[model samples]
Target: MTDRKLALAAWESLFRAQHEVFHDMLADFDGTDISQAEYDVMLTVTRSPDMTARLRDITANMLISQPSVSRLVDRMVTNGLVTKCADPDDGRGSLITATDAGARAFRAVATVHGRSIAERMSALDDDELRTLRALSDKLRRS
Candidate 1:
């Protein structure tokens, strides 16, 4: 049986930790060409084949509303960070592809952000990191 009080306490701790860590990590984008949202969109796009991904897929991965993602994509398009075109396979959908400049910018910020993440998470050893990953995955799946 679950202990209700303990569960709430654990949830609060987890929430606070995630919030603080994320807040600290935002500094990784300081003075960079892209904001954190752009980095997130490119993170999904650059991982897909040919630096391309479906708009729906990007929206699904984002924490923001679909409309917000759409607007951000439009801005990225205006800035020449990416190209968006109607998806041939899905008439109502679109495809987003990172431009050469976009990929370069993502890479530059990723390097610094990756290092910052490592430094911050270094508080946990490899085994703890693995355990945390497993737990987080399990929770998401549940």
Candidate 2:
């Protein structure tokens, strides 16, 4: 294959692999209090200090659109998974803080999800995993 064709093939393989892995990982949420989207939001929030994250930061990290994220956060608020408040630093901005219940739910799901990811990635050795991570980061940085 030409260089361009090789790149295309690699891209296609990466896309399909990611799709398959993500589909398999979704099973970790079975019977959980949070959906995958909610978990995505919580992943960012829970990792932040005090389990809080700015709405824009959450949206930036998510694959969802801004409106979708807004709606999701609103629903999360109603479900008592998180609390939303105006950012004290920026009047026009909002902040999201994971509630105690949200943290509990996230932790429960994360254990299974983390294991699932590791199991799936077990096909790659440590060196290969490091290379993959570096390549992925390089692509993102580009």
Candidate 3:
């Protein structure tokens, strides 16, 4: 195969393999009890000091759309894991805040996710980890 064609094929293969490994790792996560999207939103909201963020803030980094985020926030609110509030700066916008209970839940789920990542990635040497990070970043930027 030509060098360029071979390289592209290798990249595609590697990307798929990486995605599969991530899915496997996610499957083993303690937050498997929660949908990945839900866990992501909760973690983001709870990590901030205000423990609150606008709907637009959540949607930006998330994989889902604003409407989906709103619906998920609604469900989380109903579950008592989060509460909806008016954005102080924008009354028309909604802000999401984790409850004390939500914070506790996020902690529990984070532990699980952390453990899964640690266990699966533990075999990589420091140099390998650095190389992986560089490569991943390069792909992200591209």
User: What clash count goes with each model?
Assistant: 0, 0, 0
lDDT of 2 by residue, 1-90 (tens): 559988999999999999999998889999999999999999999999999999999999999899999999999999999999999999
Winner by TM-score between candidate 3 and candidate 1:
1
Which sequence of candidate numbers ranks them by lDDT, best first? Answer: 1, 2, 3
- Residue-wise lDDT of candidate 3 within 22-80, one digit each (tens)? 78966744424456777889878977778987778888879888888888889989988
Look at candidate 3 and tell me the lDDT of residue 89.
Answer: 90
Reference-based lDDT, each prediction: 0.98, 0.96, 0.82
Give the Å shift of residue 35 in candidate 3: 2.6
Ten contiguous residues with the weakest lDDT in model 2: 1-10
TM-score for each prediction?
0.98, 0.97, 0.80
Off by over 4 Å in 2: none
**By lDDT, is 2 or 3 better?**
2
Model 3 off-target regions past 4 Å? Answer: 1-7, 29-33
